[model samples]
Target: MRGRGHRAGRAARKRRQKQESVVQSVSLCHELQYVRLMKFLHQRGFTSTLLQPALFTDTGRGLQAVKSIKPGQLLISLPESCLLTTSTVLDSYLGHYIKSWKPRPSPLLALCVFLVCERHLGEASDWFPYIDVLPAAYTCPAYFTDDVVAVLPSGARRRASEQREAVRELHSLNQNFFRSLQPLLSQPVDEVLTCEALRWAWCSVNTRSVFMSHPSNDSLSGQDVYALAPFLDLLNHRPDVQVKASFNDVTRCYEIRSVSGTLRYQQAFINYGSHDTQRLMLEYGFVAPCNPNSVVYVDADLLCDVLRGDRSLDQKIKFLKENNFLHNLTVSSEGAGWRLMTALRLLSLPQTLYHLWKAVLLGQVLCEEREEWSVQTAKTLCQRLLQDSHTALDKITNLLRQCDQPVREQLDVVESLRQEERCILGSCLELLEGPPRQPDELLSCAPDVDAVS
Candidate 1:
């Protein structure tokens, strides 16, 4: 009996060792400090780690330049070993479950799963140093409260709903895939991979990941083109700065060339590309002042209502949609956008002049009467938008003055978005009501679409 007990003890030790190995292989994240992160990167082949985390009043946390850097300087050449990408996921213990599951998970889902799982692993996670610095919460619509979401403009309302629904649906759809990872995880997959957990992971990937092309794979539901880089993701976005960022094939490092170099002690910023104010607010959770790409998206129902009096509206709307000209209607800093003008001209056509729709679309000048109708219709739309903008702005002001609530920050973001949108509408009206001059290609031979202010 004593010999039998000894044998059992030996067996127990073997199982414990196996569990430790499995845990170590897939450990996630713990609270890693800046010093440790810098140290971690230095050891992993990063030579020029000459930056530190800094705080800015305007942009919150961003990387600060410790030394003066010149134009065309290679600001950051991050090694690929630091990237946590889908390839890393596919090679882990969870990879086999991902492969043999009845339905394949999206490449995005795979990345989110890895991040959440690793984060749950705490100190055991190999990338704990990097994950420790990631924001505990995000400001994207997915993180917005019900009260905050209730106040979004007509244009952004649909998109915000879809963003939240996407997270929820993704969580609901992938229950089996989550369950398949039970053998590798310390707890039940549901506990670690909750909907809230997935949401946090999804936002991290959406807001922080970099663009890195991946090898073609039929297994992923969509393209797997994102990679999470550690120090590289620290750079905040600045619209005016010019930079060249890419992965260097020979060096196997993700490099950034700062065309507009960051000065010493200044916060460094990167360009997220021609994103408008609303886009910045919805996807990344912020807004920019005087964004050139910013525009007010016209509501389709409002567009239809404005043209309802015309008898041929039904046929005109059909032609516009069929030709793919109905979507993307907008008003911008330059006044009525091309797409909006194009659709309006078609909608303004008299029933007898239906054949001239193509001519109108192609920038041909219709009769003075038809041109006047289109101009009047545009003016009406802009007027309605201006009223809506004013109402929202005033409501926001009153809410802020009336209370100092926690939703103040959310209200402020929406305020900036609204203000920029109002600017675009105001310009549209000036263009519509401006002096009669040479008609531009956008309109059916009417006044030039120029913003006076």
Candidate 2:
């Protein structure tokens, strides 16, 4: 028994060592690739030394400040030759053949084709250095396996489905367009535009491409509005940071300046707009733990579900549709908006008072009596939403507990989303369940309401 135990321990140690070696090899390869990419950019006029690659224990690869960067300092300036724009793709060797197709492809589709063709050329392609460093697979929910996708919350699942459909449509277009060129081409269509190849290229473009507005005098107006700005695209997103990026016609380079200062060794980030956690996850394949714009969408269907037993449901639905209040219901850090509360109040009104409610909704009159019912109805709806959110969160939490070690990281992202949602719903519930005040008290306190009335 002692001999067997000793053998087993030795085997385990060997396996761990092998795994560590593999990980180290991959890290080393990535470091080399980063160096090559940086060198490539430097040769093309990226001279700023403020940014350097910094690996985090948890966040993987991100750009860090080598020296303290002051606000308004230009951190990167890549010449037009470095930008992988639609024009560049359209002007490439592959683009020469793509233009012969019956109908010209959109800039995005053309870029995807260019990516696949360039990849097929392997080392011979001019863009090989840039292409080699692009991520092999994306983390976006759109790339999640079927089982993982099935577990996504309804909102995320819907968005993922939409993205998948878009990819499918683009793939179909590629197929049809490539089939037409197969007769003239020496290579098989599959080898040139395989689904897997197209998908990789599609995701690379989706996640890495930056929007660049063309100059008014540029002839490429209304073409592809996005470009792949190599090193600049490597900057991770933080909601708080602001960056001023633009194409400098005078210098003939793309410039990115930090509007906010960065401390030495701290990761510098760019604002990807005011995206919520869900939007970030769907589009960028990662969620920001501290996204200030994080919100929980309370769709009209959920609202309708909450008011399922209300009388004259059809009438309420019609009114909601007519008033265009059946959508855009959301809860954020500020809690539920007034529109949601007003919509719930409208639903709670009796059939006889529908006209009065409509009048109030249209700002024709002030119905003080229904104000209490509105507040009560809003509270009830919030309570239901809060309960449902908690249930969803519990399911996700339980799944996390039982999930396999390999998939736990991905599940953690879903868990973060659910937790944010729960926080939003909880906040809304708190606001709705605040101490009930008399309508007169509310009116007296609101000088604006008194004046409006």
Candidate 3:
């Protein structure tokens, strides 16, 4: 009977705690201007998964959750969250200045100021100028914010609460972090403010990594939804945004050419084109060719043109000799220009079959510079290959053998490129081979030399 009563008491306590959490959450939501923010986000096509409130504020007043939003959107955490208690304390001049200055507010910049000012400016003087805010967001002394606890699944919430408890148990954790920075803060107030703002801004980036791994769950905490919705959609940084000058008038907003990081802007502009080309050459995904002649994926003609126009021939040759043909080439003096010849010979595969593949792979064969290598090119190549896989394979094999050292090295590349798991190249290769094995039969095969070696 005592045990039964104890169980009943525990259950009642849990119910009370949950009810209290909800009430506290709703109240804090108003305090943080979440409702206003949510309304704004809704207008922008964001859906909230309001995470639990207690997880937000250690003492029970904050929020956490995952939010669903479109890519490359921007989210603005309002000015109200900072001004809640002492908004009336602003100077008339300052207030007027803020009202008149129509700098399109940056969320990253604003959040950085808020985190730092929360520690310094008391009551109403916390609003910092946006111009002073941009540097920290761009670079950093570093700042940190953790994932709001609401992004966790329901089963994990109890554990998340436990983790929060553990964090609190180490009461000196936050104090320690701040205490170590006392020397830095003793500098001029402006310097201190700038550094602290940068510090926390850096922290926010790190905190994002923690939440980034969270899987989508059906149910979410209010905080989780709120935080994520703003971040991934509206607050995401794009090179284009850097290119854009924030302005009150749309006409004046075109001053992005003067902005720093113009190369990133250039890339963004190219990416935005109707070509929608993958431009695999620009992607950092692959290392540059080791053997120029052996690799057809690179546009040798364009490279030659670029090199010939600006750089020394010797330097160009040296770059190709060092980077392309082979990093560890054992060139024999007896061979003379053999390495160069070999590199050029290897360029044949790309000139033919691989050329067609690169087009479809990059989605840009139809592009003006390489129109002959697009889908239409693939159709042409496929038609020729269709005459007989065996015949096509024989030609490829003969070409591979005669194509010099650089071309012969690509035998491994062709084999690896045929991996079913890697890319569509594998499926095409499979067709070149015979019928594919059934899943069960494929699974039953013994470990082959190809896989192990």
Candidate 4:
């Protein structure tokens, strides 16, 4: 019996040893993967690893002269202090969660990779934060892609492999960022409502800025958090996008409108390219996703000019398009019809069909208003579809419209916009067929920018 007990103890010891070995092997593999990811991030101008301080910090006098460098240059130099703050914060968070990181692989690396594996090239920037502006957010410098290739040792035979791997890493990082936010989006509204710290929840994803509706309790409603989309973000945009949470009497669902869509379209025309943009306009009809009726409009003179071999703006426009840059070129005093249409259509929204109606109504009214104003002013109005205060005002107007309260109640909320001293109404009156019924109607309906002042 004693001999039998001894044999059983030996068998148990052997099994335990085998399990430990497997664990060790798995841990080593994970560590190696983590190291490789870190190196790639460092090479791409992401994190300056404390492990390899020499890789990022600049030493030579030439480096000192160029105090401020472009993102492409920074990646090449691997400067430590110049890196984004988020990286350090994340590093600390990971360290606390992952003890004995020495030989252990970082779990975050796997999480990042899993999330970003499906991301497009445009999304690489956000995932790898080390890369310059996201392709979706802003045009990354054309040279940055080149700089990444240059980082590999000269005549490296595996250049393609290196690039592919780097791209994969970037994608993973982006996916992780979104994944982190997913929980917040998925949580029950009541649970999310428990925390009412935010005065507003402005989500700028893709090209659309989705503003959440706050109830009297100032908590997020049941609206699903919108994720950023690639094609949608590439569309032309302006700051005046907003929504009012009021149910449309015509249709039961919530309604949204582009308060400044008219001005946006007006400005869009002024900035519309006189050359290729004109051609693109004619070839591709303006598709207003908001306007279901598709009120067709185009500039004949502009089309005629493009057809006559006016390709002056082609090269410039092609370059901007390649770099993801936005420019302004007004085709006529009235506005660029195709440009306005494309801008409206390319804005793919995830909102319900009801919201689309509100969008269409907003577009028609704004377009009509802009056409009249531009004709009277004999001036083109345009801006590089940037998200700024002007856009915020437009968003505010739409939100007020969506409120469940009466128009007067809505007006009270939007009174601040009306208080603006611009001559928005005066400009619209000039385009109107006749004088407005009353000055207030002109302000409320047509709206003069100056009356608010």
In terms of TM-score, how similar is model 4 to the real structure?
0.18
Sorted on lDDT, best first, the list reads 1, 2, 3, 4
- lDDT tens digits by residue: candidate 4, 1-453: 000001011111121111222211011112443355445555644432111211111100000111222222211222333222223323433333223223332332322222222122223424433221222211111111232222211222133245334434444433433344333343532333211111001101211222223222111112322222111111232122332223233532222232323221121101112222112211111111121111112222332232233233343334335533332322222234444332222121112222332443344333335334433322222221111225545554555466433332223212222222112323322433354223122211333332111
Q: TM-score for model 2? A: 0.81
lDDT of 4 at 261: 30
Q: What lDDT does model 3 reach?
A: 0.27
Residue 362's lDDT within candidate 4 is 41
Residue 346, candidate 1: how far off, in angstroms? 1.5
Give per-residue CA lDDT, model 3, range 1-453, as digits (tens). 000001011111121112232222223234243455455445545443423222111112222332332233221222222221112212322233223333422223333333454435423332222112212221101110122222211222344355334434333233433333344344554454444454433333222211212223222211221121121211212223332222213331111122332221011110111110111111110111111221112224433432343323344345355545533221111221233233322222222233333333332222222222122222222233233333434444555555543233222222221121122323333442443223221111222221101
- Candidates 1 and 2 compared: the better one by lDDT is 1
Best by TM-score: 1
Cα TM-score per model: 0.85, 0.81, 0.22, 0.18
Prediction-by-prediction clash tally:
4, 0, 36, 41
Q: What is the C-alpha local distance difference test score of each model?
A: 0.72, 0.65, 0.27, 0.25
C-alpha RMSD values across all candidates: 13.1, 9.3, 23.1, 28.2
In terms of TM-score, which candidate is stronger, 1 or 4? Answer: 1
Q: How far is 274's C-alpha from truth in model 1 (Å)?
A: 1.2
Clash count (model 4, backbone only): 41
What value does the lDDT take at residue 285 in candidate 1? 69
Error of 4 at 131 (Å): 25
Model 2 segments beyond 4 Å from truth?
A: 1-30, 180-187, 214-223, 351-372, 383-409, 437-453
Please list the residue runs of candidate 3 whose C-alpha ends up more than 4 Å from where it truly belongs after superposition. Answer: 1-52, 55-107, 122-187, 202-352, 358-453
